[model samples]
Target: MGGSSDVSRRRFLQNAALSGAAAVSGVGIARRADAEGAGGGAGQAVDPRSTEASGRVMNPIVPDFAGEYGGKVPEFQVPKRPMGKTGLQVSILGMGGFHLGSAAGQKEVTEMVAKALDHGINFFDNAWEYHKGMSEEFVGTALKGKRDQAIVMTKVCTHGRKKDVAMQQLEESLKRLQTDHLDVWQVHEVIYYNDPDKIYAPDGVLEALTAAKQQGKVRFVGFTGHKNPLIHLDMLNRGFAFDTVQMPINAFDPSYRSFEREVLPVAVQKGMAVFSMKSMSGSGEPIVHGALTPTEALSYAMTVPGVSTTISGMDSMEVLDQNLMILANFKPLGEADMNALREHGKQFCDGRYELFKSSLKYDGDLGRQQHQFPTAEEVPA
Candidate 1:
């Protein structure tokens, strides 16, 4: 087992302290049952306090894992939604494929994949260049016989007007994933306004993607960017329609660089599936900035409207189980819960983490491309 880091230790102590306080104040934390069945319309009002008054939150409805893991473990379910316009239903919790390639060994990767499947997660995300393709390889192997049971999404990054290169990447990905086609194939790391034109230009990547879809090599089409929402919106607003979009949508995001206010509403209006990333602020920068705890940050993201799912990177079963508990026990946050979470993270959003707002590290690939094709003087119509 991995040793607890200082941050983990701190989080445990804080949770224990908070639990004790709740006990003394008579504000009981909901057990594991009530949360599963408390369904209301989107944006429905929920009383946060009543959650405690309602007694234990219900445990997630776990599937039978007797022969698989040699025993039973708690199961968690996040809600599900169809990929916009594709009509493909996917879990609200997505498994990020980043660390699956980089940090985890083959056995660990297999176990992680098994655990996620054992739970209700069916949205598996990966990228072509992640761990130089090891991530996709592992996921492909893990989902070998179960391909029909899940939605596999992956991305490919290629340079200007290179449809051939893009197609090649997709073919390689298909080979590694051991699948005939992808459910969703995205143009990865899109960070600037002019990106769409370059992608959709004659002999550009979008042509390859369109070809893939027509040939049944892929199903839904989408894009992911970490830097700016304007860039994302600009890309989507251009002529071609996207089925889904992925961007950062945590508490620190709203006050400083909010995709929720600027881009998400548009996606919702367009009926595109909105997917959230960096809910835990990936590099732990939110924690360094004294923003909300990991759990609180995740809660805030889940509460945002139009978010079909939030992708969290879980490297261990403990992390996975904790997130499962949160999702399974989720009750729509009331005004007070939302206010408290927002207030707690307000100071950290004062542009201090603006590193996340710039594509500096992506300078070579995304930044250079942006320089080449700056957003035209006229805004995208």
Candidate 2:
């Protein structure tokens, strides 16, 4: 709240709406920190604000967690893996940027990120559109002096329109994240049938992305989509190699539009890093519906062969500890184990469980027009 005050919450939300995200209701921003995790199940209420120092937000990692987590510091030992051929090693478990933005306060989100890094988690995920860029801004705060320790990634949701507009989006993201360049910059949410084609069209966002890479504003370029595996393949078949590809690689995904079945092989053949998310069905809906336990869902995703790293949204230290524990004791599921788990999840594999694949709810550009560049007067000097 302190550092981000330069852009008021009103402005943040207003810009968010203009950028294509509708306001989120029932976010529990008013909930008290001590009241976190009160629910015993999937619908359990999450504390929107961090229990960290109230209003003392924005700074690099401090040696103390006394002001956060009710005075308990999280500790864990995690492993790192190569993210394909990027030459960057990432923690087996990466932090999700969306849920971090959902938390009420900047201090809380920053502390969660610091805690994750303190415990050996080095990969931090973000997006320009997440929480009106508050997510990237918070990561910027947490990584202020410790940026080199983390492999940071964020996305752009430009719908593959104007190359200059997409370039502006990247510049805006860089300013929000307080970084001159990103470790990886992805084209976000390519869900439609023609999404890939648009990106490859003349003066498309891909032009800006590649030019940025050449200019050192971005080290790598990739694309992310959970809606359809075909869209993922469409991206690859369109030409222009990628350094990574992010997609849903959860337990139930094998049965639905199946990014795993359709896209994983292609990504592997291309020698691109396989980044997996929505392992627990994005927002815990599948786990809440009893499709699979969190461990089972995550384990299923991790052992899916060719996954560089599996990311899960963790809003609290409790969730982070549980995931770290899973990683520490993790043993890749054997073929039989994979088969049985997939079978168990097959029942709930209907598009209902994996809603992103069948609905425009997760598509960032559904009702919004392509983001346009501002007039010359609006451009910064």
Off by over 4 Å in 1: 1-73, 288-290, 359-381
Query: Which structure among the candidates has the greatest TM-score?
Result: 2
Model 2 lDDT tens row, 1-381: 222233222222222121110011122211111101111122234322222212222221111121233323435557778889888888778888876766657878777778788888898888877767887888888788888888889987677667988889899989988889999999887766777778899998888888999999999989887777777887898788799989888767887888888899989888898889878656555433333444566678888888988877766555555565456556777886687666655666667766566643344432134434332234465
- C-alpha RMSD values across all candidates: 12.1, 13.8
The list of candidate 2 runs beyond 4 A from truth reads 1-75, 365-368, 371-381
lDDT of 1 at 190: 77
Clash pairs of candidate 2? 48-104
Residue 47: error of model 1 in Å?
A: 35
Compared with the true structure, all predictions reach lDDT values of 0.62, 0.65
| Top lDDT prediction, candidate number | 2
Q: Provide the lDDT at 239 for model 2.
A: 86
Model 2 lDDT, full chain set:
0.65
